[model samples]
Target: MSLGILVAVGGVEFEPSLLRVAEAADIYVVRRCVDVADLLATAASGQAQVAVVSAQLRGLDAEVVAQLADSAVAVVGVTADTLSADEALLRRLGISSVEASDDVSAMAEAIREAVREPVRSQPEFGENGPGEAATSAEEGTPPGRIIAVWGPTGAPGRSVVSLSLSAELARLGAPTLLIDADVYGGSIAPMLGILDESSGLLAAARAANLGALDAAGLAVHARQIAANLQVLTGLPRADRWTEVKAVLFRTLLAVARRAHAFTVIDCGFNLELDEEISYDTAAPRRNGATLEALGSADVVVVVGAADPVGLTRLIRGVNEVMAAVPGMVPHVLVNRARSGLGWSAQEVTQMVVRATGLATVRLLPDDPAACDRALVHGQTLSECAPDAKLTRSFSALAADIAGVPALHARRRSRLGRT
Candidate 1:
């Protein structure tokens, strides 16, 4: 019996010729799809074992290729250009078997061969290890670092930390990207005083799902908040979490790593893998976005409230995150540290270390007034209250994360005390 084949080469003159020779090669054209959607539908029927697609097919991306592969259909990408400039792009998009020639017989043979071989998995993009510098594709410079700010339940101030850290990093002369990956509620836009009419995270997710998102595409969705800082807002509603798939979320982070000098994510609090509730292994998980961000981050800044109740949740939460992601050593940041707690930073540090085995611990002073001012103005602490003690701490924390000298504090001293 002839092997089944699906062809979706739009407007290619040689497609008719290729189809004529299919019978001789022991393959039959099962369907001639007009577009990617039709192609996917036909492939899902399991009637086709191979799909011949044009490199210029609309909406053709790695995600689509993955779907075809999932349906047990081998994809053979064809480009009209003899020089095969499109071949590199197709390969980058995860199509391994490609035919650059217009010769009908050669195309048929390529299809036959693609069916014989196992479909190879897409090559992982952005191979730079966590915290390692990536070579930017557009510019030959090293890409940015990624820092994830996460915390336990009961409002430990993850969003505030993420906003301040990103602002501080950008203020220090590094181009920064702040991402709101919190699946539950993303307050980055509102915290930064931007309208949340359009969620940048959802737009980017849609683009990634269509395999159309690149660094430039990401820029289109991100809103410019500061001279050097840009933000990708999160889901507009909590229930929209299912729209952001974990695999595509990872791809988005990879693009982010190359686009900015520092990418800070405000992650959701929940650490549950949701495997127990996930009857469909492929279904989206509520915590998938948070898990992916933590896994991709070079630095995970775990925030905890300084009070006793907060500390208990913090210690337990820290252990949970560490268990969820092995080899993850997070930086413990105790927020709203008060002298009234009957413990010094050292004591709190010791307690956290003893419980979680994480050594790095820093404290942010309890400055409700400064926090209120910043929040009221919808600005970062550094912007509204540069001289506030909390602002200095934030600057110092950003410096530690970015491996640079303290920024705003030094600038203030050089200009003389106000």
Candidate 2:
């Protein structure tokens, strides 16, 4: 079988040796060029499977390293000094392997290994390309899902719900990743009491800029919050919003999906449109980030307050959510539900149905103390207040989401099985 190859050399001393190695390996040397730019372009175009570069090549700079790292081609640096800074730099740039000696046979073996080995690539959430997505799914060390929790405006309790849901999912034995995709103002790190100075959104943007963000690269940005739960917090500052792009968010979500079984995202509120509104605007918008998260969600939870104003907001938010998200039937969550409002759970459900024509699947009681304690302590409800009504309710919601039987049925099933 003929093998495709490209050799980039700074001097003519190693040209004949490279050709001999190629011939010995029964591989067709496609490009015997000295220009690093041409070599990179050829590699990027997918014409070459393996790139062999000389350490002496002046044009093989950081830009080339960054470009090669992003491309499908496998890069191997052949250097005279294994301990040289150049060799270390190449490896740091994500080169697959580096060789010190000028031995043609050894170089050829390295090339073969690099070519035969799988190349790691980034994940594409939407309709970018099949190859990109497939590569990520197959090559990912720990493939996972990207579950984006989304809702409309008017204080819908999306953040609290998402945080609780992620914690519960992690409790259920699945390795889960929680991401804060609210570009306008992300509260995840603070809510979780994580003093994270780095935001995944910014990291993703930088990755997109260098074209180096793949499943593996994104895994580096994820911070482990629990044994099974990881978090990718939001931007540190709102002014740096320009650094984030919709494509980058999509790519990061895709990567997150591959890294864990469940990747939960706390997305922004506004789903009707994409915008970057000024601070003075009443709507508070950051369209690009929110739209991307909502578009790629596997499951979306529409959260709303239990009161009348909150219900009105939920009603309007649902309409906008349905229009913005194609082919999505959201699960509604009613927050701050209490009998003191003179409305029972059933009655509140009825009222919401009457107003929005959507059923409430989950209801959380108004327990500001419990929530405040958990947020302040950086602990989940299960850890902070396991016996609280809101905690129990949230546990039930998680059980339902994970398809666990209800309390009564669980007891009966256990007795029957026994």
Candidate 3:
């Protein structure tokens, strides 16, 4: 019995010679696909165990390769030059077996090699790879941390907290990447006074789709807002969420961890799981980006308003998120802690603890004047009001998270203010 193969060389003139050599070696050509869609459909039919694809094939990307891998179709990429940039790209696209298009004689061995390799398991996002040890040990760079700011409906200030936290962390000498992963409505670009029509997240997603997104590629997309703070702006329109795939988003986050000491994501309010009945299993979900961000986060900061209705929603939201992601213990942050709300910090903490069983709840004092000033100027609170209590609170939180001394956190805040 010969090994079944699907060939999609995309107009490469050497296909006939490669097929002749492969057939001579007992490799049968099951189907010759016209495009990536045809290749995928043919691979899914279970007739082919190996796919010989051109490195320059139109629409050939990591997602297509992933789908092929999912279908148990091992791929052997044929590039014009084995040592050229295309070969490197194919390798980055997770093609382990590659053959030079001009060298048709070695095609059979490449097919056998691809089939010999085991299907790769999905890597846990943010987990360090094998090569990370030597690099980290040499550079003395610790693994970066991811903090996802999420909240219940009714505007619990997720974006505010995310921006403030990232800015504060950067002010404390930690490099930070602020990502707006809100699928419903992402306002980070406008909030930061960035009027560019292009979105960093969307750009990064495109690079990821093409298997070209690395730390350097991500930095190209991210706009440097401060000396130590860079921001990956979110979607321009809510409906454009489908353009950002969840897997690619996870890959982007993993790349972000390599480039920054801290990544703060402003997540969407929804925690609903992808429904099986309502949508196709392979289709993109509106909340998929947010869900991936939360899952990849090292810390989930659940923010909520400090009012009666807000508190009720916060409690239920916390429970809902916990149910959606088991073993997730969030750090609750009650925003806008005003005396006018008729509740002390202790009372709010007690209420949150009694309902959500959280050990501690951080309070962010209401400073509408400072917030409004920052908003109007498109600057962070530290820049506008470094001495404000709210700014000090954020500095303290950053200090705690980054292991900076809190005793002089306020002084440092003033010193680090841009």
Candidate 4:
């Protein structure tokens, strides 16, 4: 029987050790300088049956994970720490074994076992192949309106805006679906006080990979949050970004529209590229899930904080959004707006207009108490503090979006007619 081939990923620290282990195990070892991009390239080249990667390698992205998944290569992650959330994320991305103790010989044995085992394939969600284009019926089904709430790097209260806006829309009798598309870090489930083990994105990505993600399959995985609201949470693991691609996201939106009346996506900050690229040629680049979501959104809500740094990020983020998503008219929502450090709402709006040449549409007050309470309770603003200022503001925003006329004015008009 032929000895399995092993690829040492990450830096040169383990090269000599790996070679010795390979000799002892009677296996051929190839040392590849592992970076995210390089790792993906190596996997794509099909040169090695097993990959041993360092946990410390930066830019460990989803595309690399997906590449490994598609290649059926057994991956073993080496870390300095014993166990951590980061290690758990690596395992979620399909790395079969994690060696944190740096046991080079044991790592060799693990690699051999990984190569000997049958490559595990993700379960098919439906009949289509993964990453395939949507069919005509699926495309025409009107999945739902994708309302994406995005903002600059600083804390602009994306999760707050997302939850509040979704709740408000639901109150207006619009069946709403809230999706945590913030691939970097999303707090929807935590904020809602729901311990969601499954993220709709994972199921969608898996279906996309198998070309099986259709309208029917999306309904199966989506979790209903309320009578009029559903949510698709972000990936449980950051490395799972591999399964999600631009094509899959587009399909997800399409399917979402067909199932629900409205779909609200809490997209991540940073819209520069599909993924973050590395200064090093060897490191893998970050995937473009955020950018893709922004591009496909019907309405993009640009949020910013009341502080200087927040304002700066907001201005820069606006320009970036415009550049990447051409013809996307954004609605600016200034979060935590208050008279701070001699800056008023009017002054903030003026500065924003001057900097980005865009107009501000709405402002949300700083209601930290209400927000914290709601998040802790895993309840919406409507349930926790419907009378709160931020809640009312979000309700107004929803009314505007839904085109509902003012209550007193409508009543008066009816009286006049009578």
TM-score of candidate 2 on Cα atoms, chains taken together: 0.63
State each model's CA lDDT, in order: 0.79, 0.68, 0.80, 0.67
239 Cα displacement, candidate 4 (Å): 3.1
Clashing pairs in 2: 143-258, 144-257, 144-258, 144-260, 275-287
Worst 10 residues of 3 by lDDT: 129-138
Per-residue accuracy of model 3 over 1-418 as CA lDDT, tens digit each: 5789999989788777777746465788898899999999998888998999887679988778877877888888887778877776776665767788767668777877767878542322223321122111114577799988899999999999999898888887778999999989898888778896898999998887776777767778998888788999998998898887776777677778777889999999987755545754344577878888888888888999999999999999989878766898888889999999888889999999999887888999999999999889888888888889998888888888788787655555332323
Best candidate, lDDT = 3
Weakest lDDT window of 10 consecutive positions for candidate 1: 126-135
TM-score, model 1 to reference = 0.79
Candidate 2: deviation at residue 350, Å?
1.1
333 in model 3: Cα distance from truth in Å?
0.8
* Candidates sorted on lDDT, descending: 3, 1, 2, 4
Error of 4 at 35 (Å): 26
lDDT of each residue in 1-418, candidate 1, tens digit only: 5888888987677776667756574877788999989998898888989888877678887667866876788888787764565665665566666675457677778888888888753424534321112234455677678898899999998998999888888777777889999999999888767887889999988776654567778889998887778899998999898888776687688788877888999999998866647654233478878888888889888998999999999999898878877898888889999899899888988998898877678899999998898788888787778888898898898788777777533473211111
Task: Report, for all candidates in order, the number of backbone clashes.
Answer: 0, 5, 0, 28
- In model 2, where is the ten-residue run with the lowest total lDDT? 409-418
TM-score of each: 0.79, 0.63, 0.85, 0.63
Model 4: per-residue Cα lDDT at residue 257: 62
Candidate 2 per-residue lDDT over residues 298-368, each given as its tens digit: 67778888888887788788777777787877778889998878888888787767866665556789999
